[model samples]
Each structure stands twice: as C-alpha cells, then as structure tokens.
Target: MSDRPMTTTPPRPPAGGGLFGRGPFAGAGMLVEKSMSFWPSTRRLMRRLAPERARITVVLVLALIGVVLSVIGPRLLGWATDMIFDGVIGKQLPSGITKEQAVAAARAAGDDSFADMLSRMDVVPGRGVDFGALGTLVVWAVVLYVATSVFAWLQGYILNDVVQRTVYRLRSDVEDKLNRLPLRFFDGQPRGELLSRVTNDIDNVSQTLQQTMSQLLTSLLTVIGVLAMMFVISPLLALIALVTIPLSMVVTKQVAKRSQKLFVAQWTHTGTLNAHIEEAFTGHELVKVFGRRPEVEQAFQDRNEELFKASFGAQFISGIIMPTMTFIGNLNYVAIAVVGSIRVATGTMSLGDVQAFVQYSQQFTQPLTRVASMANLLQSGVASAERVFELLDAEEQEPDPADPVPPASRRGRVEFEHVSFRYEPEQPLIEDLSLVAEPGHTVAIVGPTGAGKTTLVNLILRFYELDSGRITLDGVDVTAMRREDLRSHIGMVLQDTWLFGGTIRENIAYGNPRATEEEILAAAQATFVDRFVRTLPDGYDTVIDEEGGNVSAGEKQLLTIARAFLSDPSLLILDEATSSVDTRTEVLVQHAMAALRSDRTSFVIAHRLSTIRDADLILVMDAGRIVEHGTHDELLAAQGAYHRLYAAQFSGALVTDDDEVSGEEEVAGVRG
Candidate 1:
C-alpha cells in the first residue's frame, strides 16, 4: 500500500434549490418561501417515487366533488327551510294542505325554488298546476344529500390511501438514506432523532394530510359559498355579517402566530424526550451495572417534565382558538338576525329572504370556526414538514463525479499522502498523515485513545473526506471512485459489531450473498464461530437478535470475522477487532485474521500489541501523524514510542504475574 493521502474536492451546489429553503428569508414572505419547500419534496415523491396520476387523480376528483357538494348542501338546507315556511305557515295550511303547499314542497326539492313560491300566486293558472315540478324539487333535495354523503366518503377513502401509501414510501426512502449516509452523520445526530423523523414526523404529516387538510379546504369553501349567497340575498345584510370576519381573522392570526412558535418548541422537546428514553432503555445494562438508576430516572423525569410543559403551553394556547371563533361566530349570528329582522319588518326585505340570510349567516360562521381550529392543526403539520424538510435538506455525502472512471486494475496497494482530516475543521483529528501498505501485506496501527487509529481506517474507506492531500487505491484517486463500487470491494469489521436481526447464516453471508452453505460453514469454522453455532439447536440457522445481543461480545466479533472472511474483499479493515474478547477468543480471532489476510491487503487498528506483533509493517500514530513505522522487531530495536508502549504493557504484565506467584508460593509454604 502507498502512503499517499486521498484528496477531496469541494462539494458542488445542487442543480436547484431543494425542497427545504436554503435561501435567505426575505421577511414575512418566509412562510410562502418555506411553503415552497413542500413542493420539492412533494414533487420528488410524485415524480420519482410514485405515479402522480393515480394519487393526484383520486385526490382531485374527491376534492372537486366534495367541494361542490359541500358548497351546495347548505344552500339546499336554506331552500328547504323556506319551502316549509311558505307552504305550512304562510296560509295556516293543515295536515292535508292545499295544492299550493304540495307544489311549494316540490319546487323546494329541485334546483329552482320558483315552483314552490309561484304556487301561492292568486289566480293560480289558467292552465292546470304542474305538481311534477314540486315532486322533482323534493327528489332533487334527497339526491343532493345522497351525493354529498358519497362524495364525503370518497374524499376520506382517497385521503387515507394517500396517507398510508405516502408514509410507507417515505419510511422506506428514509431507511435507505440512513443506510447510505456516511458514518459521520450518525456521529453528529442521535439515533432517536432520526427514528423520530421516520416515525413521529412522518406520522404527523400523514395525519394532517389524511384528516385536517381536507377539513381546511371544506371549511374555506363553505365560508366562501355562504358569503356569496348572503351577498345575493341582501348586500347590506351580507356586509353586516362580515363585520366580525375581519376581527375574527385578526384574532386567529394572533393565536396562530403565538401557537406556531410553541408548537415548534413542543415538537423539538418531544424529540428530545424520545431520544432520552431510547438512550436510557438501550443502555439499561450499563445503567444497572454502574448503579446509575436514580440519576438516569431523574434525567428522564426532567425531559418528561419539559415535554409536558411545552405541550401544555402549545395545546392550551391553540385550544383557545375554536372557542374564541365560536364566540365571534355567535356574535355575528346575533348581529345578522337583529339586522335582518328590521329589514323584513320594514317590508324592504321579504320574509323568505330574511330567513335565507339567517341560514347563510350560520353557514358563514360555522366554517370560519372550523377553519380556525384547522389552523392549529396546520401549525402542527407545518412543524413536522419543517423537520422532514430539514432532514431532506441535510448536507448529503458529496457526490462522486458524474462520469466516474474506475481504475484500470487494482492490486490493493493503498496510500495516504499528507492526508489531514477533522470532524470539526478547527479541531483537527488527523493531520498531515502519511502511510502505506503494500499488496498482500498485513499492516497494523496501534495507539492510545484519541490517537487517531480508527480514523485512519475511515480515511482508507473515504467515509470522510480529507482536509488536504490524496488517498489512492492502486494509484487511482479514491475521491474519483464511485462510493458503492469502492465499498463493495472492501470489507470492514467495526469495533462495535452489528448483526442485523436475522439468522446467523444470513448475517455471515451479508457481504457475499451468493455464498453457499458449504462456504459459509467453512468461513464460520475458520473464525471459530462454528463451535458456538453447533451448540445451538438450529445451528447456522439460529436467529441473531438485533446487534447480535443474544451472542457474547467475543462470539459477535467471531461472527464479524466470519463475515469478513466470506466477503473475500480486495482490501480489509479490522478496527479494534479483538479488543473486547478474552485471551482464548483473541487467539481464535488472530488465527482467523492471519488466515484471511494471507493474500489480501489488510489494515488492522489494534489496541492489543501482541495481535499485531507479526505484522509486515506497524504504524504508531499520535496527533494524526505517524511517529514510528516498521515491523515489531524493528520498532522494538528503535526504542521509540511503540517500544515504550510495548515495554510498559509487557512490564506491567510481568509484575502482575510475579505478585500473584509470590502470594501463592507463600500460602503453599505456610500450609506445608
């Protein structure tokens, strides 16, 4: 392997601004700007993931039909009320009312109320009365109600379809992003936060779309249609009814403005609590081992209290809107009634007109009140949208070149030349590092904690880009190589072994899917994992719990070794491979590593000096620079940093043995 560092180029700006706004907020128009974020993620969902035609068609058809029926239904109810008044109360008609009453009823049922009103005209008609008109009107009213129900149900069905399907796709997309994201992303973000994104955030968005969004539309349409009808009846009365509209709108705006901020806080606090709970539960073993139960509980209680306070503040303030709207709506209703009564009494307005105006006033206020409540719900949805967009907008691992060209051939010669990197730019983790591992050689990196040992492996994998210099595989720049292709040819055994929830055989075969049972068994046996597998009732088919929790740490490491062996990778990295295992297990792991690295270029970051004593080359890193390099014998002869560490650990071991032997010998002599 060569010691040339892998160079990194700056990230390219995206082709277009993504769904989440990256632009500077101009002012109050930021809501509109941020709303635009909804479009990109939506468009991606529509164009890339699912067919727009299917979901869009369903939603539009349902919304159109529902809006039409929703708008027309209230007017029909007003008409029906007018008919009852004219036919039953106008002439003091009894149970077996006159032809006028029947005719009035028919016209009330139809689109036009002319038949119902005209039936009362003196000198009814030289021609016989057309009762068919009244019958048609009654039938029309029933049909409209039925149509309304069908459309409403259809709207609900379609909304549910969109919510469920959209969430499923979205979750799958998020999981894939998590899988592909660089290891550093996890370092910066808590697992719980990402989990909340997949679960809580998406669920909020889904619930909003499925439920509240349609209500908002329906309420808006109702408000509009009612106002239009009122204006038609009497513009002056319509003007009176709208007096409260502006006031109510002002009040709602104030409430929304305040509640929006609280809702955001509420959601943020919820994520914090969720993360804390998850962490607490996942580390319960450590908590018990260290007897930190009280402290952990107190921390959790503090987070819970924060969530409660935020939720109470948000919901309490948001809850005021509907009641306040209802108050304003009732006030509007009284004003319209008082005003319409005078017009009717003065003979300036007909009784029917006044009655219709009263009904229209209710229509106007009811939807307005509903819309006020929906505003609160929408605030919650927007919060979730903001979070989802935030994730989507997160700086992605910079892309490789569009037309990446793979190396003509690779002999697994790796190099790091003047490579420097840092998790944070100001606090450099690895600086001016240079190293090399020739093909078919085993190289070891040993260092104390914070010595940038594992960081070196990260550089080789290009999991992070270097601040300066270049890394190459067989002289081809790794930065120019396709990430998937680069990773496919490399195998890694992390310090913390993670086995997906699956069978042992499946986990081992993860790196190489086409491995036969025979190959898998051979790899397992080579790693000494087959000894434990044979004891299990299901043998290789035994299920592994998440992260291989069912297995001991040593066994998990052994399984990881088996997996690496099965991969047959061109380049292999074992980070702290035997650190958590016993001496017996370490020997087995070492034997496995030696067998696997026979002809492959391997880089090992080991805390145990004995494991790497036989390595072809050893690198001692400190503060991101190699201070020593050579075989174990060469480094020991040099009496450098590597020699000091080795000598210290070896001396400590010898002293410990001597003390134990002395105690035993003394006891033996006394007994004799």
Candidate 2:
C-alpha cells in the first residue's frame, strides 16, 4: 500500500443551494474583512487537541531526537576530516597517496591482514583519510540519517492521527453549533461566510498541521541544538554565528507584520468571491429571466478583482522573506569564515574546529530560512483557525431546561402571550402580543411586508427566544422543553421546498426513519404524490438529482406534503405550501391539506386571501400589532385591515396602507 496518510473533508453539498449562502438559501454579506485575535484562536485550537496530548508529546520527542542526530552528523564529518589532515602531516606523505602506501601503512600500524583500507581513505592529500576514523564516521552518519528517517515517519504517523482527530471533532462541533445557533444568527449572517468557515478555514488548519507544523517543530529543535553545539565547538565563533538571527528576525518580523493583514484580507476576499459565485450560479435562472446577466457578471468581476489584489499582495509580501533571510544567512557565513580563519592562524582554534563551527553555522541559518518560509503557513493557518473557532464559539441556543418537563400528549393548543421580541436590541418587532390557537383550530396570520409573520412561528419552534413572554404547547412552555422534543411535535412546509438528492423512497423516509412500507405508501397516496410516482419509470425508486432537479417544483412540494403526512405531526406550519403548484394541482393539494389539517392545530402564514378564506380565525397584522382578528366574512363586514387586504387582492390591485385601489399593479408580493 502507498504510504500516504488519510485525511477528512466535508461531504459535497447538493446543487442549487443545498448548503449555505446560495440562491434560496442566501444569507448576509461576507465581503468585508474581519478583525480576529490570533493568539486566542491558536490557544483554543491547541486546547481542542489536548485529548491527543500523549501522541503530540511522542511526536515532539521524535522530532527532537531526529534534529539532534541530524546536527551531530555534520560535526562528526568535520572531526573525521581533521583526523585525515593530522594523519597527512604525521606521515609527511606525497601529495598523492596510492593504494600500495595505504596498505603498507595499514599493515605496519599493527594489522597485517586488514585490506581495502585504501578505498575508505580520502586521497586528496599526501596522507589519505584516516581509514578507521573516516569509515566509522561515515557509518555512524548513515545510521543517524536512517534513524532520523524512521523517527520522522513515526512522528508523521502519530501527528496525523492527532490532527485528523482534532479536525473530526472540530467539524462535529461546527455542525452541532450550526444547529444550536439561534435563527436570528442565520437570518442576519451570510450563509456563504459560514460555508467558507466550515470548508476553507478548516482545510487550512488541516494542511498546516499535516505538513508545515511538523516542519516548524523540527526547525525550532534544529535552531536550539545547533546553537548549543556551536558554543561547544568554539564560543567566539558561536557568537559570530549568532549575528544572523537578529538580522533574520528583524526582516521576518517586518514582512510578517504587513503580511498578516494581507493574509486576512485574502481569505476574506476568497469568501466574498465564493459567496458571489454561489449566489450567481444558484440564481442564474432568475438572472436571465430578469435580464440581469450583465449586472451579475459585473458584480462577480468586482469581487474577483478584489480577491486578486489580496492574494497577490499576500504572496508577494511573504515571498520576499525566503530570499531576504537567505542573503542574511550568507552574510553570517562570510563573517564566520573570516573570524574562524584568523582564529585558526593564531593557533587558538584547530582547522577541524573551525570547519565544524562553519557547518554548525550553516545548520543554524538553514532553520532560520525555513522559519521564514513557514511563516506564510503559520499566518494563513491562524487566520483560518480564527474563523473556524468563531463559529465553534458562537452563542448557542438557549440552554435546555434542567430536568425538562416530561413528554406529554400534544393537543396542539399553541399560545403566544405578551411576547415581545426584536432580532436587534434597538428595533422591536413584536410587542405585547397575545394569541391563543385552540386545538384543531386553523389560524391564518396575514400581514403587510416585514410584519413578522414567519418570526412568530420561529418563536413557536423555539428557534429564537422571546424577550418578554411565553409560548406554550398545551400549557407546557416550549422553552421549558427540549428543543428536539418540541420540534418533534411540529412539522413545517414552506413555499421553498428542499429535497435531498436521493431516491423518492429515501426522501420521503427522511421524515420518518422507522416508517413501514404500508404507512409510507399510505402517506404518499394521501398527499396525491403516488399519482405521479406511479407514472415514473422507476416509480418510488427513481433517484432525484441534487436539489431534486429531476422533479418539477409542484411534484417536490407534493413530496414534502407527503413527508409531513408520514410524520403525523401534532402541529403543522404552512408558509404558502401550495404556492408552487399549478391551479389544478393546488386544488387537489388543498383537498389533501384540508384532510391533513382536521383535528390538528395548524398555522398558515399566507399572502393570498383566497387560500385562507376558510381559516377558522384570521389575524390581520399591521406593524407589530393585530389590527383585525375574525373569520373571513366577519373581517370583510368589519371593513378593517383584512377587508382592505382582500379587496386589493380580489380586485388584482396592489395593496397599500391607505386602502386605495388604482389600476396599476407593479408592486410585487405573494398573491396579494
């Protein structure tokens, strides 16, 4: 098997906005730069890896050993060279030593049978290399290299385990956090930004951990080990070796300071570009229908140009660090050479000692150059980690009640009492509102734009917390119950349908994992989905492509209804559920919905007055207050907000607060 290590990446989301920040799933803008604290993000990330502390420690130990062994090899070579020089002087040999002389010398030294010594000795000088010492040093050097390789492999094996585990846990945490985050968090935030955080940001951290971070540890160990060895060889020369560090640091620090902002801007621009691409691709159909292709392209081009500038700036600035440090390292090498030559001439230092010091100096400067190279990875990783950590650390849903109230039968008697809320602290949307939805009652909430219709159900689902009041299901406060339990008692179908990429059977079964075939087929038949499913070549087994692209919008809506039917929820929320179907399909679906609504409390948020005409109670909302509350006939007789809304819609005129009916119908709204 190949020696490549395993890694984890998120599953690809389905097309047409299956993930975040695309088309129908769009969220807030993410083009602006974010100010992130690096050390805090780094600390939080390290803490997340605490569970793998033992493995990390082992990897670190191996790195230290490898670095020490690597440093020792050069010093050993220098020692062996010095030994060869000493032998040359002692023998007073010719400039070219032959095999005959090497053999004769070896025999005379006390071993008459030791042959092949000539091959091991260096013949550049009159006396060849000290065969014994040179051969021993060469053998030991190879051994150290082999041992270093093994340790490096082991380090990689263990470190990869730690990094992947950390990534796995972090990804799981992000997923859980997304679920726990309040709806307002999503409503006000850009989905693309969140998508970038979960994907790009995490990948950056993973790449750094897998590759550059290990290199960083080794480089650090090398610097320390080489420094100590240099001092051991010659304190004066070692001090000369130290000259490169401050110069390198000053250069690296200056470049890094400018580069940090550039890197942050680079990722921010990347997210922005991705956001636009996602939006454009998902909404390409709308763009064409509205003749907005040029506008969309211009917007995309603007974001792309911004991204290019950021990327180029980040890379150009960081790219200078390597060559700059390399030049400074060369200067240090020259200083060491000059100082050591004088020391050697004065007989204060041996040729071998000077040679070893030179080697150690190179060893020292090599890491400094590497430190500069890895700085880019370090900055990029920290920037990305900060984003990932932000999502992980975001405020979660209000904590579930301790010892939550026991599960009780759901009568679906929902009540909103004196509920006051604002997505923003300064802008209140709902205030002092009180409403009781009786069991088996159909309550239709109609409102002008920004009237907080959907926000009401969001509160009921415990997706957001009420600032000052209680929402209850059968007298049990929803907030007092577990979110999962509260959600289990409710099912929702919105105007926008989201169908996963799967077979028809699987998509329907998503609503009821343990549902039987008979029940599934029954639900399908009840929602009139079986009428179309039976006509398909694969029937229930037909696979829906990503975003259910294979199916018509009306068919997708029917499937959702069928899914809801399969769940048999105690309470149902419909936000214009039939708005996607044709007139004939709508009539049939309405018949199915009428059946599904019986004996179950249902809330319908609608704009079309005709759809909710039969609603048992209609609450006409204006601003944040209910201006009219009664049945269709009653409200029509009252000539109130509901009456005005119905009059405009019934006459195919645009609605206004003044209730004037002009012939022009330019203002866009949901049927009304």
Candidate 3:
C-alpha cells in the first residue's frame, strides 16, 4: 500500500541461524541437529501413488514370480554339483563295489571317520559320472534363470510407466493449485522458492521414484525367497544368517535417522539459494547501479556453502550403510561356512545342501544391503515431497458465486461504499472509505508515500477483498460476478511494463486476441508505437526478449499503452502510466490517453501535479482518508491539501501556518 513501487525482495536466512552456533562448520553441525516430519511426509508420499495401485499390483506379482524362479535356480545348480561330486567319487571307487561295501571296507581298514563320510555320500560305486542327468539339471537352471530375468524386466518396465504417470499428475495438480491460490498467498512467497518446488523438488521426487521403486520391490522379495530357501536347506545356517540381520538393521536405522535431517537441510538450503539467485538476476541492474555485487556474491556463497555441507553430510552418513552391511554379511558367511563344513564332516548334511545354503545366505545379505543403501534416496525424496505438499495444501481463494450476477449495462460506473481493508489485522490501512466514479469521468487520485495510493486502485480491480462493505461495477456487486467476467471489461496500464517473449504484434494482440490487424495498427498508431516500430527493421514483427532488453523503457511503456488501447474496456486504471516516458513522449501519451478515456470511467494514480491538472475531479488523500475532492481549480482556490501540494510542486518549498517545514511534512510535499 506504500507509494513506493511494489517490488519483491529475495528471501534471506536469519542471522545467527540454525541450531548450531554460527561458525565455519556450523552448517555441518546443524545437518543432523534438525528434525523433520519424516514418517508423516513419507506416508503422504505413498498415498500419492494410490491411483497407480493396479499397475503396482501387477509389478508385485511379477517380482514375486521372478524371485521364486531365481531362488529355485540356485537349488537346481546345487543339485547338479551334487551329481558331479557323486560321479567323481564313484569313478574313484572299485567298479562292482556297492556303497555299503565301500563303507565297510573303509571301516575295516581303520578309517572310521572316512567310512562315516562315505556313508553320507549318495554314490553308486559301480557307476561312472552320469553326464545326461548333469546336463539336464544345468539346462533347467539356465531356463529358470532366463525366466527370472524376463519377469524382472517386465516388472521394471511397468513400474517405470507407473512412476512417470504419477509424476505427470502431480505436476498438473501443482500447476492447477497455483492458479487457485489467492494473490495474498503469493505476497509473502518468493518467486524462486515457488519455482524450486514446482521444478526442482518435483524433479527430485520423479527421479527418486524411478530409481528406487522397482529396485526396492525386487530386493525385498529376493530377501524373502532367499530366506525361505536357506531354512529349507539347513535351519542352523539360516539362523546364523538371521543373526546378521539385527546388526544390519541397527546400523541402517542409526544412519538413516541422521541422514534424514541432513537431506531435509540440503533441500531447504537449495530453495534458499534458488531464491537468492532469482532475486539477484531479476534486479541485477539495480545491484550494479548500487555497487552491491560483492554483497550479493557473499550472500550466495553463504547459502551455497550451507547447501554443500548438508549434501555432503547426508551422502557421507548414508554411505556408511553399505560397507557396514558388507562386514556383517562377511561374518555371517564365515559362521555359515565353518558350521556347514563341520556338519558335512560329521555326516549329518550333504555338501550340495551346504553349498546351496551359502548361496542363499549371500542372496539374503545382498538384498539387505541394497535396501539399506536406498535409505538416503528415500529420505531425500520425502523431504522434497513435504515441500510440494505444503504448496498444494495452501489455502485457496474463496470460490466465485454459483450463479454470477452480470452487470445491467456496460456503462462504467464504479462505487465504493464504506469499504474497509488492511494488509494486517491490527494495523488498518484504509477504513470506511467511500468514493464514486460516475460514468465517463476521469478521476485523478494524488497522494504521498504510504498514503494507500496503489491499494486504492488494487481494490477497484478486486485484487483483494474488502474487510467490510462492497464494490460495484455498473450497479452490480463485484463479488457477485465471476472474477474473470469482471476483469474482462477492465483494462490496466501499470508503471512497470510487462511483455512476454514474443514479437511486438503478438504482445499487442495479447490484449484482444480477436482484434483485427487493422484495429491493432490503429491502436499502435494512436499510442505512437507505430512511429518507433516503423524505425525498426522488423516494424511490428520485432521480437522482444524475456527481459524485454531489446527495447528502451519508453518504448516498452508505449507498447503497453497500445495494448490497453486495443482492449477498449469500459473502465481503465492507469497507475503512473507516464512516469517512465520522456517529456515529448509524455505529451503524445497524454493525448492518446485522452482519446482512450472517451466515454469510459478512468482512475489515474499520479504523483506529478501537472499531469492531473485537467482531470474532471481531483481527490487529495492523506493517511488513508480523502481530505479534499473537487475540480482542480476549485481545490486550488480553496488552498487546502490539494493547493499546498500544487504550491509545493511549483514553488519547490512548502509553506505552512507555522512558516516551518517539519521532516514528515517535507517528505509528503516532495512525494506529492
């Protein structure tokens, strides 16, 4: 509401920030110090995937089939190994001797332990190696392996499709949420922070889902299948492998708890850094003019350092899981090997069963390691999801009426009856203010800094809702009309010109897409845009950059004016429209405005006294109230607030009853 131009400032972190004391290593220290809503956010993220449950169910079934086939292959290979071992042993024995005879012979030769091992071996002493049976086992193992791979591939392919579609819906919802949010919601938010949520955070979520979804599913199912096989082979070895599980879990839990906080900090710092960069680049010219590049660079460095520390700490802590898991897995392997070998020597278990158990133990431990390693990615993804959910859950504007009331006619008559408003609840900016702009009248509003000049026009456009009373356009309450329908009949020309990246003709056509080419040319000529366009090589086809740097400030203002001229609205709001134009251009703009204002209600907010001298009615505002309202000449004759403002402009000094200028009064005079 201040008279100063409304500009967005970059968000900054608080000084002496974070849980740790400010130091070079403070960012690192704070990484694991802050806590987040990890479980709640993760649950909500899971809920976001609910719509893809059908595809997920299909993937789960495939993964289960693949894991079952995979586990069966190792067992089949174990069988083949047993057949080869038996054949080799039988070939070494006498050709017609039975297995019992060999054991008895060994026992008689004073080799009881050897006899015991020979009794456990399933060997036909009279037979050589059976190549046909061995080959059949090997062939079956290969087939199972191939089938397992095919199932895994199909599941992975389907999972990827599900993830992509989920992310697509999320992006679309975010875009729609932005449109539904009220203008006030954006007032306190930084543009870059919002952009980071929509672009960067959402992208991180997509990548996390893509990388972890199928892998996590497959790993978990493999662990189950492998564990069941190990038990079937040898319960003792299975129990040994199970011991390592608790140790692996303890390590994973500790690391994940620490890394979750770090990942949250990392994403938070990313958003802050993005906000600073956006603000810096947006106002780069101002920074250079003020010689504040070093300051901006220092701020960027501080945020970048914070992000770096958080990221490093997260990756480093989470990286601990794999090596620690590998160590525990090795211990399990040693225990299983020693026990299985002893059991084999004792003639209580076959060598092939022990071999299969060893393979199953490795398979079980490998999946555990994969799951542990994925903890960091899961945490990071949930952090980003929480941020996105916050945006999606923001309070939206009140909905439009179910059945909107259209205006009785398109005659531009606006009324503000007992309207009250405030940016903050405790500090009122406008209170019980009333005004009327009759049809086809030019109302000039002149006010000092912080005198609610901009807020007044903003209220007319329904950019904000009044705390009390109502605004009407053509005898119908504005609130009863849909916002789009109400704004369609109004045109605005702001001091800060805005043009998208497009040709000059396209920018003008943005005002009225249905406007004919001849009408567009007429509007441009009326606003003197064609005069400059003719000078350029491309004329109306000249392209404007994203920042519109190709055109001068005056030319930009002229183009905006031409756009407003093309709209031909019933009501026009011009807020310092001529502030950026040169004196010569101002004359042309003033003439164009005069023609544009014909038979239309117009509100002009200006600080320059000369610009509004010819206005039909001049309203002088001070401290949220209108102190004087009348014709310019009548106000000058009265020699009140408007007269003093006019006198200050022409005489360059404010004269008061006390014949002395107070600082506050002097500032008001200068601003007026």
Give me the candidate number with maximum lDDT. Answer: 3
In terms of TM-score, which candidate is strongest?
3
lDDT of 3 by residue, 561-638 (tens): 899879999998889988888889898888888887888999999988778877988888776767789988788767
Distance (Å) between predicted and true CA of 110, model 2?
Answer: 34
lDDT of 1 by residue, 1-672 (tens): 233343322222222221122321111011212333333444444353254357656766676676666556555555555554544443543345555665566566772344433453322222332446546666776787788788777877766776677777767767767666776766655556667767898888777766774676667766777788778778998898888789888988888777776766667666766666676666677678877778667766766777788678878888898899898888888888887777654546655677767777887888788888777677777677667667776667878879886867656889888777877655666666767788889989987777777778877788788889999887888888898778777889888888899999999999789999999999998888898899989988889888577888888888888898898888889898877788987887787778777768989898778889889999987766677899988887675677667755655533234364443344334324
Q: Rank all candidate structures by their TM-score, best first, as comma-separated numbers.
A: 3, 2, 1
| RMSD of each predicted structure | 9.1, 10.2, 5.5
Q: How many clashing residue pairs are found in candidate 1?
A: 21
Clashing pairs in 3: 3-450
Return the TM-score for each candidate structure: 0.82, 0.86, 0.90
lDDT of 2 by residue, 496-541 (tens): 9989889999888888999999999999998899999999999999
Residue 470 error for model 1, in Å?
Answer: 1.1
Candidate 3, lDDT over the whole model: 0.83
Query: Count of backbone clashes for each model?
Result: 21, 2, 1
